[model samples]
Target: MAKKAVCIMSGGMDSTLAAYMLRAQGYEIVAVHFNYDQRTQQKELESFRAITARLGTGQTYEIDLDFFAAIGASALTDRSIDVPTGGIEAGVPVTYVPFRNGIFLSIAAAIAEKEGASVIGIGVVEEDSSGYPDCREAYIEAMQRAVNLGTRDETQLTIAMPLVHLKKEQIVAEALAYDVPLELTWSCYSDEAAACGVCDSCRLRLKGFELAGIPDPIPYRVKNGVS
Candidate 1:
């Protein structure tokens, strides 16, 4: 039997590319997505389904955690705080979602344990990503250790962060090489109709594509000559 991997896909370029990388490595993908009532939850869910179909993976999970809205701390889940569109800031952005990756990984670990998967893949880019504390390599490694210690003795799962150290440009190049459906992915933190090109997520994605010398396949709402 082929090794099974639970890929924590967020319907974004990074996670989709990570899933494809695992598929290329001969692992049966069990794609997992979360709907935490974010601003672009519907759009993200749509992208997730489309990406999963393109991956041809039958095993998929869409878990909804409505607690994010109740918590209401981050800009993504809370409507009061505006998402930063000026530029990438120096420290952690308002859209960090307060230990979002850690929560997602814990849920992924549960899914992995239930599915008997040996690996849990998450696409967390440290270098070119929004400086979320949860996205750090050391934090993820610590979570992995904690997961193993908390799970059953027979269940040994490795958290695979294939894009941990990769730059956005490198990620874009690799995603194109793998023929990932970039058009089907969504990364905007605010707008759901069309990607707000000025937002941090959109800017980062666009910059990566620009640096890679490849045009982004997705449409963007031009803002201040950007897009």
Candidate 2:
């Protein structure tokens, strides 16, 4: 039997590319996505569905995390906290959801344990990220250890972060090489209709495509953003 991997995807380029890499390695992908009542929830969910269909996804977990809205601090969930449009700041940006990746990984662990999967795939880029603390490789590794300790001894799991250390440009180029559907991914932290290109997430994505010498397939309100 092929090894099974429960992939925690965000319907973004990074997660989609990570799942594609797992698929290329012959893992039967059990796709997982979370709807956390963010500003772009519907758009992200739409993108997740499209990407899964293309991957021939085995089983999908469309988990709704509504509490994030109530515990809102980040701009994505809180209407009051405006998403930064100036540029990528020197410190942790306002878009960083509090322990968001940690929570997602925990839920993904439960799904992986229930599904009898051996691996849990996440797309967390550290080197080129917007300084989200939870996106750090060390934090993810610690989560993996904690997960193993909490699960049944027989139900061992490997937390796979294939893009943890990669730059956004490398990710963009790799996704192109794999022929991943870039158009189906959504990265905007604010707008649901057209991506606000000035947002940090959008800026990074645009920068990646530029560095990779490829035009991003997704529609952006303005292709030019803060460098």
Error of 1 at 101 (Å): 0.8
Residue 37 error for model 1, in Å?
0.6
- Candidate 1 residues lying further than 4 Å off, grouped into runs, are 223-227
Q: 137-214 in candidate 1: lDDT tens per residue?
A: 999999999999999999999999999999999999999899999999999999889999888998899889889998
lDDT of 1 at 7: 98
The 0-to-1 C-alpha lDDT of every candidate, in the order given, reads 0.92, 0.92
Tens-place lDDT per residue, model 2, 1-227, is 76899999889999999999999999999999999999999999999999999999999999999899999989999999999998888988889889899899999999999999999999999987898899889899999999999999998899999999899999998998898999999999999888989999998999999999999888788779422
Candidate 1, residue 213: the lDDT equals: 90
TM-scores for candidates 1 onward, in order: 0.97, 0.97
Sequence-dependent TM-score of model 1: 0.97
